[model samples]
Target chain A: MKKQYWTEYESKVADDHYYYERSCIRQSFFTGSEEVFINIVRDLLGKDIADDMNLHTCSGIGYYSGVVPLDTTMTVVARLFALMTEAGYKNFVPSCITSFGLVNEVVDMWHHFPEKLEQIRGYLKEANGKEFDVPENIAHPCDIIYKYRKELKEKMKYSLTNVHTGKPLKVVEHIGCHYAKIFPRQVKGGAEFPQVLVGMIQEWGGEVVDYPERRHCCGFGFSQYMVLANRGYSAANSKKKLESMQPFKPDFILANCPGCTMFMDRWQYTIAETEGITYGENGMGIPVLTYEELAAILLGYNPWDVGLQTHQVQVEPLLDKMGIKYDPKDKYVGKSGAFLGEPEKPTHLKVKAYE
Target chain B: MAELLDMISADIRYIDGLKACMNCGVCTAICPAAEFYNYDPRDVCNTLMSKDEVAIAELLKTDKIWHCGQCLSCKTRCPRGNVPGLLISLLREVSIRMGYFTESEEGRRQYAIKKTLGEHIVDSGYCVHVMHVKPHLHPEQGPVWEWYFKNSEEVADRQGGNYNKEGSGALRKISEESLKDLRKIFEVTGGKDFFEQIDRQSKKKASELKKNITDNVDDNEYFYHVYREKNETQE
Candidate 1:
């Protein structure tokens, strides 16, 4: 039976031009995912987008993690808006989910207190000698894709069905906390049950598996994970999600936020190593893919070409299930199409002979 | 004294996070951090409600305020419309401003983040740059990352990123003029003062702890002490 879904807000479409602001964690942890997003938007969808070098980090991590103050964080975000305004772009599309939330929150804050907005404008003019008009539309890349899921599906070279099994792949979606929790009304499908990811899964021909703890955090709690002692909190929370989802036997986990994606992917390995236990079938952890990576695969892009090799959890099992052809030998190859020396076999995976 | 109340009232987050606390413990029930540690957002709100200066000061100096993940889950679940997450933000701000951050082990580690992410934004215009993420520092990135780091320029170019290039694309170099404006924004927005406050408090704590204080956060003994210190506790 198809689970019921409803979205409180309508998704925004970028149409053509987007002022792309990159995420800090996404660039460092999953550089390839960002690459895949730009390629799909430019090469596949043929949309005009500008990734401005002048835009600064949203400073969300520094503020939320308790190091940078709120005022500074807001000011930094205002400066980014100024950069976008200067570039003559109004459609704000942030690469990071946290930045998307921060922008929304700052805009809301400014609305409630126009004085604060005036204060930020004063500071920006004094500092950079410029002013900015607030963006007419601010959307996450996932939201943009969600708005155009039907178009993407029409252009898709592959579906989410397993090529050999002739059945839909069972997929689970994890939404980041900041994506909807702060302002539930702004998100598609509200916070209790978000359909932003589900819309993509459905359009791509995948069965969305319902599981307990679906709304729980991926536990990238900046300080919670950064502090070694507090990592148990992260592990414990992830363990809850893993155990709850293990019963459904999901083929893969899909995430929108880069931080959540990295944490869910990497922490599965950590939990397996530390606890001497593992989730998923045959004790091999379920692969976690960012929404963009999933989009790239569904579009028939090579898994290794999209940089799946860098994942802590191997994605070969999923590729094998989908009957996707990729050269394992090229997984670690450099951009120059040269071998980067063989990577030492990952400790978690059992040895297998090459065909 | 009324000064504590005055401090809380000065910030809008405090005003928003604290309402009449009904003490329902719903925030605690929904808190992810509370499950792992002895953290309770309800308790934080309760204590702040006491309006006691000594208690407020003590709360600022302890590791409690740092425990919140700032996921704002409490904001979502709180029936009374109170947001403990925002209260925690206000507490953290006050703590750093007053040098109370050095009083706790978790609080002291603010230096590490300040040096890495806080400084990275001003220096590079990006919080987490490709070259700055050392493999040794983030071993979870695994062996593939080491290779990528060595061949980053080539890989980035092939992947459509204009990394370190002087043009518009992913990870492109920010012009010197823009960088100057960024630094000026910090100065005008009080971000520079906030960073200086963290440095001054860290230096003072280093002297008190008899650790060598240096001009650079990377070289300072106090910085290393906080960054390298490990908590032996495990769940």
Candidate 2:
């Protein structure tokens, strides 16, 4: 028997409802991106989306990091599916690229080995006393957005072209490893050259820049970075990517995975702070944005309102290029629009406005 | 020795990751861990194929398996279709199961990951929650994150997350019934067993090393010892 993989896009946008599964890292690092996703789906796309509190983390990090075993990881995924079934959701949208990959991988695994599926079913029965119907439609928000790029582009208040220069912004797209690498055919483009992110960037009027290390991992390496001692391995890889992309002079980076986004964003700061070396022009790092964040920006959401203020690398340079209007005073303000008092700006940030 | 080799051969990850090694250095050339650490995936595959039980056992007891970032970059480039990343996963599993994980400095730190992420999942329903990722614990989250941690609830609220409140939004309180079901799933799926085994093995290691062992995951001296131990060579 030949090894079979998904060759076509297998997911569709939920016409009416979607059970939005949260990614642990995304909610933790880019809190506003999830909200922006919800806004785009619910308020903009006119879909009734529910980010259920019942949905647990996919434990992708734990499992991939080798702390959690595969069987346990599958069961946890099975339990989440059961929760989705209980919630009466037939369409699934994952917030994290890693979670998206895990869910797809588990579903495909169960498909290939019915015995394992039955084993997980038996476990689910023992645990919840319920049977789960696998979601009919499952997609990462990126996929959903990719599918509706035309509609999104139509709804956009801003394009990816620089407002000042009137030229398309040079954007680099970093696809998470789990997004397509695990199951290449499942993604829009095969793993070798994925276009899921490129589709979004192009549709939003940005020039997608391909660099030498375009396929490099963001170095989250879960355990490699999580354990402080092993962080050098993670940092080294990120440094490699920074060095690879430095020549491109990308105005910004758009990542589909929260881990990738966080790492690509955070590790630049880490590399510069620890190693005293920086990438990109003028020793200022390229700003990294989650796909949802870029979407929020294109849809005219305030930069500060979308939590760009929380980024270690100042997003002001990109915002200025895009001519996005945001108040510096409002950046540190509370939910009720009250100023929370400013944090002493770190010296690493080269942007005078942010400093 | 035959039994140990059988265990390796039987593991699906091992089966999936290895086809036939031609001693190709592609896996190492592309390996991020190899670039920094004294680790090589080609050597790992070569040793596993050697089927020497002592060498395999020694490999498990060393920090070598831990060095794999599990990026699966090896899977992408392997001309023989071998996945050294997956091979690492299987080795790590067997090491933990056999208590060989406690034999190395890096391997002993598995307990810290087990306690932090393992307990975080079972208790909080999420592997990482905003509340649990304290600024003090994760200084890499930086000063803004420190502020966010202090004003997390408000920040969550502003971002349209439900935080700890009840409703259909991010970080909302997972229902007790659902949490119960989650716990049951863990129980039935052997997740609890896996965690307990890690704890038991680590405790035994701690006893041998003359470190204090406590039932409480947080208060356990061994847990804190590994968790806070910084690499002298980190810089």
Candidate 3:
């Protein structure tokens, strides 16, 4: 039998299971409001969670789009740490859609072909001395989050309604590329825009604004080539999505990933300037947020605690537009809502350091 | 002045994509070219807004922008959805419009490659996945994957890939036609002859580089030259 099938059986038998994997964007989540959300999940649900950064790169979508080498990606994922998630009896869960998708690809590939898997195993053993046994039910944070938004909402202390004086947020979602591409059926609780971000936003009192390019991947693929000064294939793709999304005039453009937020927010000003166009009122740019960043606001966490200001593009204009006035200058108060406080360095550091 | 604004607006209209930007900064943080260089997608946005063409020209001069490994990571990870990889191509338009496409050996090489890609797609209705190789006469890097995939056209025909040819081929053709239709959009050779030149001579020029490396250097050295050395030249 394939390794994934057995893992599926094991996953069904066990109730409380979770795993963490590699990411460059994980830095955003570990910092502020996202950290709070993770803790809430653990305390409120009593599920197991593992976070690690020393893991191999997820091959990223760069490979899929025909840029990075295939074998290098395999070596990075298969040889380095896809196997690490198999331990301690918890299902591996990646917060990044790319990482999660890579997990599924690797597990499915190595399970069926013993010889090819051995070659991959040998690559791992030779390159990093790591052998992966494939985890039981490797999945995404969205997979679980989408399934459990109702439970999450019930346990919340604050309300997303009345977030602004009365205006519901004109929020649109930035679904990660891998999650939408690889696990579309799972997150597609039947909507043009997936239900997870919409459900969380609308229930939390933000109005879901469906744009034409709602299911688009922000120009992160060409992000690495950004030195090309807006003259690369990726930039062209970025413009494609931007033009498609231009009609909606979303107050807040929310994303599930750090990379997405940075690309949409940080690059807009350049797109505005070089192109000599006005992006927002008074030439203001669109405000991009992570799901958890919005979660913190809706949950009544302070703005800074959610790292709203840390964003390259300002969120204040959109806040004002939505009739929500978060003092962007609010300093972190070290409040521990459910999971963690502003640690001396952050306790999660110890986990990766220990590994 | 209207013409100037039109040209200027058109040049930076790629920024309309920035308006499309969700401001996720995935392009900034994940950008390899941005990481190593003194570049930031955010800074690029700010600079673009400043509209100081002097600063813009200075920024464009850096080959750092060209160091893009052509990895579509930025496009894939983009959340509010934009394609920075395509932006890099637009940036390349700056050089093309400057009339430097055939200047340096490297520049000529790039022109040839693009010309080949443009030609082959028009001819076969699929992307060029392989390069033509001729042993002893052609250079080592000369053939590319073309020898293996040379038969893919037939395989495409056999496997129903040719059916979608209308979708992609016509799309590229329409794009090329619309670009040409833009009375002002210049430098991209829109004529069919341009692509044919690329297709005819790609193997010849490829052999020139292939022999330059294969006869003189080891495989590892050649690999390093391609994957590393080229990127290190920050010009």
Candidate 4:
């Protein structure tokens, strides 16, 4: 009966023909994870994923933070759909889960209130002289990865297993709240236990730790972090998740949302600095990777090129455990082999530096 | 006060989120904010269910509206389908428009958001541009970020980001034509007016607090106060 009930919430993902919507914050936070994802799709899988430079943000951050009004958010969303319409694509894929939820929420609102849709249509026409057809399909990047996890596993150079112990690496997968909690039917699995990241982790030869606070948010509440005064709430919430997962002894953390990935990574250092506690083994912090980064590592992309170094919690410890070989010297080098200078190390989180 | 209630009643979030509440604590029990902060989604619903204008006005004027993380987790658990998170969104907007956002520490911090995320949307077509994640403002971003900040162009190019360049890819420069349309959308939809309201109310509040306010939005003394000032009350 439980299995039967969960199956009712499964979402349908499009096979191909994706109009890729780049996330504004993902680029700022995760740096090159989007590029890695595009490469995995276009280069590895031979999928046709299109991107338009004219495309802008969905204004989700501002909208959720309470500065941008709903009317403006709706108009901005309409313009994105217009870009998709102009590009001759029906499938929409947003890199950020927040954008995914924002678009879905706006479209759902439009469906329930056609008057709001009509008002937005007028605003779009008057403002930009453009119109948009609602997209036929909307999928997050993780949904795409989950759909083709088998094909990716076939092309893998490494697995999530720890090469030293020969055991499946234990991982804690944090799904962004907006990814499915708001609308369960839109995700691969239901809201309670999303299979979007779990499907990928299992396919890549990893063990998923079922933590008590698994459903709790990573607390990248837009205004919570944007305003320094409220950041304690963000940190405290993340700490709760980390503390809950601590007893599970997970090897690393992975998240689909860029904001969650960032907070989970950085807040480890913040926790270490302020509270003098670390979640991972030894004195090192737990490595936090995006779904794209995890895929890139297994697919044999250069660690630096995939932007693993951008994370505050060092990925080196995890890389070493996985026995993925790379010249530590190349970590800070430019694309042309020119060496970029190393950054100062922190007092708490352990980061490997080579002269 | 009645006008404020009318404003909230007209919002789509309010219309969709608040159906009917039976004073159940299901939402509060599951809420992450409730665990950390002195927030209860049940109390918020109970207040709205009463429909008392004075109480609603007081709710809007306090930090209670801003206590929500906007995770919408409350929506998933509500037996009556009352989404307290969405109601909070409505309450927050009404708070800002009514100039009641300046009444508390949390509400006043919307000024920081206005200068950063709010302004970034109009100026860069991004809520968070790559160039704006300065290491100084975001110390949590850590040491590697400092290196990334200095060698931004080289690193961005290597990572396949367009990094303010024309054409397609990650962090590509959004075209001027597209930005003009985006700006016009903000204008047509009253987002520009909303930004002005945040600015106007925030400036008035700054004067009330006697902080050194200036025309420079980013570097002003009042901006610094709201952006960095630690309110220990949260802990």
Q: Which model scores highest in TM-score?
A: 4
In the order shown, the candidates' Cα RMSDs to the true structure are: 2.7, 3.3, 21.5, 1.7
Model 1, B119-177: lDDT tens digits are 88789877777787776555655555676677777666555667787876666776777
Score chain B of each candidate by TM-score.
0.93, 0.93, 0.47, 0.95
Considering lDDT, where higher is better, how would the candidates rank from best to worst? 4, 2, 1, 3
Better of 1 and 3 by TM-score: 1
Per-residue alpha-carbon lDDT of candidate 4 for residues B109-208, written as tens digits (9 for 90 to 100): 8888888888888888889976888777788777878888888777877888888888987778888998899899989999998889988998899999
- How does residue A119 of candidate 3 score in lDDT? 66
TM-score against native, each model: 0.94, 0.92, 0.52, 0.97
Could you say which candidate leads in DockQ?
4
How do all the candidates rank in terms of DockQ, highest first?
4, 2, 1, 3
Model 3: lDDT equals 0.46
Q: List the residue pairs that clash in candidate 4.
A: none
Better of 2 and 3 by TM-score: 2
Q: Residues A194-303, candidate 3: write the lDDT tens digits.
A: 55676677766667776666665565553233223223334444555667666776666777765566566645644654565534444555677777666556555656
Tens-place lDDT digits, model 2, residues A1-355: 7743434534345566888898888887788999898888888788788777667778888888777888878888887788788888888788888788778878876776778889888888877787888889888888877877888899988899888889999998898987877767667666777778888898888998989899888888878776555666677777888889888889998999888887777678777776767665566778999888899988899887788877777788788888888888777877777777655544574545423
Candidate 3, residue B19: how far the Cα is off, in Å: 39
Per-candidate Cα lDDT values, in order, are 0.80, 0.80, 0.46, 0.87
Runs of candidate 4 with Cα error greater than 4 angstroms are A1-4, A353-355, B231-235
